[model samples]
Target chain A: MAEPARGAYRELVRAQIRSQSQYRASFAMDAALTSCVSVLEILAILVLFRVTPSLGGFSVREAVLIAALCEFAFQIADLAVGNIERIAEYVRTGRMDTVLVRPLSPLGQLLAGDFPLRKAGRVVQGLALYAAALVYAGIDWTPARALLAVTAPVAAGALFAAAFVAGATVAFFWIDSGEFANAFTYGGRTFGTYPQTIYPAWMRVLFGYGFAGYQPALALLGRPDPLGTPAWVAWCTPLAAAAAWVGAVLMWRTGVRHYRSTGS
Target chain B: MPSAAACPRPGPEPESGSDFGSDTRSDTEPDSGSDKNTRSAPDARPAPIPFRDSARAFAALAGAGFRRHSTYRQATVAGVFTNIVFGIMLCAVYVDVAGASGRPGGYTTAQLVSYVWVGQGLLSVVCIWAWKELAERIRSGDVAADLLRPVDPLAAYAAADLGRAGYAVLTRLLAPLAFGLLFYSMYLPQRAVTYPMFAVSVAAATLVSFAGRYLVNLSGFWLLDIRGPISFWMLILGPLCGGYFPLRFLPEWAQWLVWCATPFPSVFQVPLDIAVERTSSGVAAATVLLQIAWAALLFQACARVQRRAVTRLVVQGG
Candidate 1:
């Protein structure tokens, strides 16, 4: 059983890679489409700088730096995962039954598909934006800062992946149409592109409100927060993501258990 | 012995119209649709009316499309929430950059704000820059049945899709248009005549976008796998078409590059510009000409290709 489980994981990964390669042109195009979307969003920030230089003490370069960070974090988080959206479909079609019958944990199977390798395109474009921020904005990037920059994307990706997994896990129970749910998953990343400082106070309070809510912002521009932010906000993006992911895992297990008992 | 020599090769044309020649994927649904909609006296059928003659049909379609869109009231509001929140943040940044007083290239901060809001909201419905399903239908050859429909295939798809697009306009599009006006204090036309003109321009944009998608989708007929074309075009033109952001915000070079390549801004920018009346009369006339030209060129090409497809199949008796 254990051997077969290992074999299945390997086979699924191999198959996914092969499938992606088979549709190389399609994969490339999807990557390019996503890259263009991110670039368009970035252009919006560029337009902001055109009329004047300073945006409340933030220069055009600085704003772009911030936008770049947001884009980077968003690309990493949003693009890296695809399988998360299939939860309802899997549940509805009894494909989940195959996972249940398998020796390996279904969570592992879910995770395997959830990580979209095609997301590499957005990730590259995002990294270019972040790099531009460093060069064009002339940031003081010491080795420590560079290492932190590396972690920023990984952390953001985890955070975004966690949000998607949580959403997918929730859909396992209701089995309702997940159409509107995309507005949450993709929309959150799109909404997060701008600095959170621009958002309304009530909206700020509703979601992350803190620097943690704006990790892409922080990892980008390190938003100058008066509420004792700089000390730990940078670390919180990954921590919050980890916590969210853990919570999502717990939820998924609960949903699975419910499925087992309900036998639906 | 060569494997080819061992077994006789099947010709491209099938022996019978009823039977789809042997194909792989033994599990997929076979015989999806009949080859022909009109078996005998095919010319007895009325020719498909040109798009110009379809005004009554167009208006009826639009009206029905509007009602169809309004049906998903909940989905509409949820979409509004995301658009408005993002609009505020984006507006804040641009306004600050525009400086203390309103005005950049003759665009006031308020006007620009409103433009961004309406432009952003209308963008979702006005331009489907990254249409995925068209390629899907073509790749799977489900378009075979779509071809047999009595009405024009592209028009039928447009009629149905336009409803959703119209819904995007009413709920998603209007929310931001109104939000920009009320909350953001956006610019409005002085004479109020521009409102109707804006409506006209917007309707034209929707149809053009639909026509553009049909052309893109028609690629699937010739190319069994259309991922290359669809993906490539989507990557290049999706953002250029004003889906993610406005072209007014793009760099001068990008603006010029995108303007000529696909007339993406004509979908969202030109209409919004008409409302503000920034375009000179000459440019406005030119813009209108370009939009019509693109719509006509793409629409005609689709018809020609579809006709050729039918002729080939019938002659080959496949």
Candidate 2:
């Protein structure tokens, strides 16, 4: 028999989506605001850009492409999984009680809620910038390469969700604040949005432990190894995060056990 | 959490919510079955720090305050990371603007890009968001509390500020620095003399920043809406201080205006200058002296405000 909780979560998603649809103007306004503002932040950089400029070793235009690539990758992280992160709150605040008592698995129900319909605005801006980069950077695009490029983001998106899940799981036991986990999840995104070569050593290690910081978009962008990371190392970057994702989940389950004792 | 300041700064009074402890105490408080569950999760959970009551009890209270705050930590973490991404996006724009073809003041496109990363990293925690611990005391009509205390109220405020500053710098400043180092080809200052100078400059900035913020916090004692004053301060301060972008990139007149008009230059420009040794040794000493002057003046202003508030209280109610 199907669990009622799963159905309820579906309803929650449906309701949120419908509510967002009803306030169409508000949704559009917020969307437009975010997109426009984010773009302006980028435009500021463009104002400072001089033509045919060399940045470090990379051309100004190439840096733009890397920037946009990371932006697109970052947006993928931001827009894709609005629900999973909130589930930690559900678990922490005793809200999970309602979900658990119902027939559905709390995780299953959680994964179903929080449809990020509005982030389309963010996506539009990111893609627009990305397209501009394509024009400016003048990269050769092919069917096979395009397919790989697309997969890079999708896989990266999945990795982002996984990181959230794992990070949130830590919050379950600690049961106080989940900001540190956010540092890894959102922090990684911010760090990743740029070419992964501008920061210092400790930060690089945060990503390098498993290509934890650099891999997802790196895979999509063919891994711009500003640090001259080995080809094999670059290839393994996304997988490094993938490992963290799985590790985080296992950690979450263990934390849940702690929560059951402490929080329940 | 009680600041005793009535209208210290222009912010909302937050008295409605109860303390976080009242929500989850397992003593006489209702023990939902969930309490038992916590007992069994040994390795998975941290033992609760027992609350105590001493002058040192404050240390525990701060710990508790942190625990109470952990619930929001997840949200804060998300906020910071999102901020970092925004920073990255901002850096990209700057990188794009500075091309191999153009270098400003001998800084190439790449160095400028790296510079934004540093600036963003700095702003995550260290900025002139003012509070008036002194002003707060005055506004609260607790100038009486100051007269009665054994130690100076100023010293008391400094202790508390240092404690909280310790917490904020970890989450806000250090975390992003970690991200920057890992992700970018960071430009580090090479000189040893610059290191000590940078430290001294940072210390000066901190003192000045503390004085300004403490003054702002004090406004809460007098104003129902501190946001107005805060926003006004931020609106002018954000750009003038070289917080939003590098001072070098702002137009020359604007840059000169910031340097001459406000305390903004001291907070940011001096530190960077010292880091790069753009200022000669004598000039650096002069800069440090200026910071000491500002700090003394602000501290004096705060004490004067306190004395007036205290005198008013004595006349009316004391």
Candidate 3:
């Protein structure tokens, strides 16, 4: 059963890629535009840093590294569950009935359908920014640090994807809850780009504890918090991510059980 | 009824109620005079009698748009909450960045707070998100009917959008500003001239923004899918219009580029400067004039492009 499900997911992705390739011009334009937008955001940070040498005691290079890691994790998570945004559309158009009748889990089916190749632009941009930050930040880059760098974004991506799933789950009750979800999903991405110390204590507590992106960003940067957090806390990213994922899965199951299908 | 018969049907129902002209006919149905004039003779229709006919038409369409958008109360409330959340986050960043510098980029902490909050309030007003309704209508062949209408499509759209902006100001704008005022030490403009100048600038900015988006949506006539251009516009315009940060924070050379190249700065940044007293009254007055100039220029450009597009549609028998 697992093998067949994996095969079906792979086939779905393959078919989507093939269809997307036919619109190469549109795809290239979209990808370039996405990258351009990401670059503009980085430019805003550079402008800010021009006036001030440090943001919350982190050097400009460290700040950029934090932003890149946050963006890298965000783009990866976006690629995974970006289709969740369409759940509201599905509900509105009564297409949820089709998914309910399918043998596969509705969440699994959604994950397989509509793979967003366009987001590759953001991932590529994030990688480039990450490399630049790594070179400039003058990190010691020990084996452990290098290993942490590689794993941190993946963990952060899982947590962010969980945020997406949790947000999508709310669509079962309110079809137009994208903004509410965005307050966490996109909001988390924005918050993660900055050092958590810059925020008010209450904000730091809310985002840092409620969302998992903050820990992983600090872990990737190998930086202790300006707010007096212990260095060992950086290593807790994976645990935080796992906890978030488990919670997201349970919430999704409840949402699925409670979903009264909209008629076709 | 010949022109009505000739008008092509929009293919398939649009998925969302946001689509333009979806309920436009029904809203305009009670105004029997204009409906008779439009249906009776397309070519023989008299020149528009300016204020009487067009004014009434504009008011009716604007009222419908205002009422239609007001119905989305839940979306408005959610948007307000999101804005306040982001507002607090942004205020924190600005405060942190201004630490000990007193006034980075010549803006005091209070001024910076006011800038962010005002920018938030004005965001939906100068929204750069290309209204995709026109583009979708063009793709679905619904624009054929739009083109045959006795009224100029550009004017009609501008009127409807003005109504939408009015509604947004009441629902979306005040909450964020009030939130900022409550939490932060926001700077209010002290000069007497600032209030009227800011009002004029905002109205002109809305019209200018509508014209820019109108041109973008009109591209759907040529490009079957316009998502690429729309995304590009939002990305470029949002920062240029100072939605992200005060344009003054940018280097002088970049500021010059914004001033010379685009009317974008007039959209949000100008009104914001007036509100924060960042500009002298002379400069504020000049900025308002610039917004009016952009509005007139862009509205004319929209009319010209629309004429060309409609002619192409007619020639191609769309």
Report chain B TM per candidate.
Answer: 0.71, 0.66, 0.86
Query: Over the true interface residues, superposed, what is the Cα RMSD of model 2?
Result: 11.8
Q: What local lDDT does model 2 show for residue B232?
A: 45
- Off-target runs (Cα >4 Å) in candidate 1 are A1-6, A31-44, A91-107, A141-143, A169-184, A209-230, A250-264, B1-74, B100-102, B127-129, B178-182, B225-228, B242-245, B250-257, B276-286, B308-318
Q: How close is candidate 1 to the true structure, as a TM-score?
A: 0.77
Candidate 2: misplaced stretches above 4 Å? A1-7, A14-33, A36-56, A82-92, A108-120, A175-177, A196-249, A261-264, B1-163, B166-245, B249-318
Ranking by lDDT: 3, 1, 2
Candidate 1 lDDT at A255 equals 81
Error of 3 at A171 (Å): 1.7
What docking class should model 3 receive? Answer: acceptable
The better candidate by TM-score, 1 or 3, is 3
Location of the lowest summed lDDT over 10 successive residues in candidate 2 chain B: B1-10
Q: What lDDT does model 1 reach?
A: 0.59
**How big an interface RMSD has model 3?**
12.9
After superposition, the stretches of candidate 3 with alpha carbons farther than 4 Å from their true spots are: A18-25, A209-223, B1-45, B314-318
Q: Is candidate 1 or candidate 2 better by DockQ?
A: 1
**Model 1 per-residue lDDT at A56:** 48
Residue by residue across A12-126, what tens digits does model 3's lDDT show? 8888777776645555676789776456656777777867777777777877777777777777888888678778777777788888887787888887787877777887887
Write model 2 residue lDDT over B1-318, tens digit each, in one string.
Answer: 000010011111111133422322323232235455555664574434222212333443344444543444644465456446545555554554454446554566556544555454445334444344444445445555445543345544544444444454566556655676787666666666767876677667666666666566555445522444454454445545655455666657866777666676676556655654554777877887777787787778776765554444531244
